[model samples]
Each structure stands twice: as structure tokens, then as C-alpha cells.
Target: MLPVEIKSILEKRAKDGWVPEHEAKEILKIAGVPLPKSAFAATRQQALEKAEEIGFPVAAKVVSVKIVHKSDVGGVEINIKDEKSLEKVWERFEKLEAFEGMVIDAMTPGMELFLGARDDEQFGPVVLLGLGGTAVEIYQDIAIRMAPLEKEDVLSMVRELKGARLITGYRGKPSVNLDALAKAVIAFSRLAMDMAGAFSSIDINPLMATPDGCAAVDARIIL
Candidate 1:
């Protein structure tokens, strides 16, 4: 059964064919997916408050239903070290068309990775893992498995990646916690299966993997 809050969001956006990034993250949180600390603010003051609450050196992005690729339109501002920078971001973002508010999140550092799920017509729900960030396309290294993945399945997907060594630690860099990552993947897969009919696809880019654990940095859900 879907959580009442998630069901409410889906019903409200049923006609839109997609869930906004902030709301998508909310759904992921409810599904037990780890995510960076974040909050939605509809005003500059609120943005500032949320930023302070989450601490400095955060990332703030414009939230709007019409804007899918935020960075393309200068809707993303990262490494906001203080209130002044956040205010500046607010002033600029407010000028954009269809501006709704801002989603302020703590800046997380780690190896970038991608996790996604799609409702495949022939195979039902499927999950994918890959090298993330801007190089995801350039690397073209990924692994996929059907939804409801077990811990072993998640580990296997990680191993199948050509850049799997990156996760296991490379050149003096510390290795990420594979156990935590597997738990996250299992949760994401379960979410995919739970929302199979309501969503067409789900993407979590830059799933930050660190020695401590993993966290979703950004996400999108298409209905």
C-alpha cells in the first residue's frame, strides 16, 4: 500500500504526467532511500532559513514544473557558502519564467553514481546503476536488473560496471560502503515496483557514494 502522503502527491499531479523534483525526493525518502538534507522554500526568507537550518555550503535550485533541465537555464546554484550568496541566487532564480520556489539541499561530496528505474513493457519494472554526473553519457558504463532487487543483485550490478573499481576504491581514494549502497538500491527497486503503474520512469543522478553511505543528490519521476 502506498503511503498516504505519496498517494496524495500522485493524485494531485496525476494530470501533469510527472512529479516535480522536490516531491520526487519526498517520495524517495518515504521509500527509505537515503537523500541529502533538503527543504522546499517558496520565498527568499524561507530559502535563507532553510539554508541556515541545513547549514552553509549548500546547493539551491529553482523548482518549477516547466523546467526539467535546471542547470541549462542557470537555475542551479551550488556551493552557497553564506546567506549573501543564497540571496543572490534567489534574486536571479525569481526572475525565471514559471519559477515556483527553491529546493535547498546540503552539498554532499562523494563519487557520483546513478540509479534509475523504468516501467518496461516486456519485463515490467527494471532498475539501473551507472557512473553518474556529467560523464555518465561519456562513460556509457551501466548495469541493469529487474525490480525488487536483492542485495546480491545490487552488488552484481555494481560489479558489472566497467568502472566498478571506482566503487571498490581507486588510487588512494577510500571505498564506498557497499552494504549501505545495496540497501538503498533495494529500496529504490521496491519503490519502482510499488509505483509501477503510476510512473513511467525514475532517475536519481549523482547518487553520492562515500565511505559512510549513499545519498540521492537529484531525482526526477515521470508518470
Candidate 2:
């Protein structure tokens, strides 16, 4: 069974087919992710279809072999309202050497949060929860737990962050669905544990904890 919203998006994409991105981009778009408009170098016609499926107020970025984190390298554009912004960025991006091709996707909206998994030689897989923002590094507000976690463990980690009080339900929000975020965290942990040989770390920061759900806006799988 699929959520009404996600099933609709997937069906639309399935009908149109998906453009394949490098392993870097694909790692960010997991089986559980739902996007308003997410495509992997999809055709122009398919891009329009995805836009319709996901709706306006989208985002587009450059996916290249040389780069993985778009924002880190100034390859990301966000909150694209009209198609004009889309073409404008696309053209400018094409001229830029840092970018290879464009990755068009729907923009997600909500509060920012962080989750990560790291394989420790001594501890095996460990999960992390951090207070997200421009000051994530300065503040360094994060909590950690061992992997292969239960729902209860995930819940505890989320609560461990003092900032999480604001993330959960600070301003008339429905607690930002920590359960949903927790499930993603646990799954990421399991994935890290399963694929430990391939990477040293995985980070999903500024994960939007929306009223409806959560989306990993940014990710890094260090290999």
C-alpha cells in the first residue's frame, strides 16, 4: 500500500520513466522518499509531467561525476517558482564547468532537522541526531546511538536533542512526525550496517520535518 500522495507521484513517474543519476544522486533518493518533482535527467516532456505531478515551486540542481553535494559546490538552485527560473538556471549551469547535467526535482517545505549514521570500528553502526541550521557546525547539537535500533531507540535519540523540542511541536505543529523521521533514521542505520564496506559515513541534514512527512533535502555517503 502506498500513501495517496506518494503513489500518485510514483505512478506518474513510472508512466513517464525515470532518468538515471549517478550513485551519488541515487543515494539521496531512496525507496521511501517522496518528491513533488524529482527526476534523474528526465526528458523535457517527462520533466513537464513530473512538474505537473509534483506541482510548481520546484528546485533543480546539477548532478556531476566530479561533485556530489550540490550546495557545497554552489551547484544547487532552490524555490524555483516558474519555468523561467528553471531555464535560466539550467542555461547558466550548463556553462559552468562544475556541473555536468541538471537534476530537476520538486522542492520540499518544512522545518529543518538532521540525521546521520557512521560505522565505528569499535561500535559498529551508530545513529546521530543533530539540531539543524546554518550553525549546525558551530552549535554541534547532536546525539548518537548504536545501530540496528528499535522504534524506542529512535524515539529516545530524537528527544535527546534539546533543540528537538522546537523541531517536534514548537509552534502548533503535529510534532513533526518524529516517528516518521525515526523510521528513516533507523533504516539509514540498517543500510549503513549492511553496506559498511562501501562507505565510512552517511549524513542527511536539513531533512524537512513537514506537517505531512519528512524529506532528506541533503545527503552524503562518504566512501
Q: Which stretches of candidate 2 lie above 4 Å from their native place?
A: 1-37, 42-53
For every model shown, the clashing-pair count is 0, 3
Residue-by-residue lDDT tens digits, candidate 1, 111-212 = 999999999999999999999986777888999999989999998998999999999888998889999999999999999998888789988988999999
If scored against the real structure, what TM-score would every candidate get?
0.97, 0.78
Alpha-carbon local distance difference test for all models: 0.92, 0.64
Error of 2 at 194 (Å): 0.8
Candidate 2 TM-score, C-alpha based: 0.78
Residue-level lDDT tens digits of model 2 in 1-223: 2235433443443432332233333554453433334665534454455556666777777765456546676777888787666667767666655455666667877877777777788988787877775567888889888887778887787778877777768666567776777677766677666655444676676677876777776655555
Which residue ranges in model 1 land beyond 4 Å of their true spot?
A: none
Worst 10 residues of 1 by lDDT: 133-142
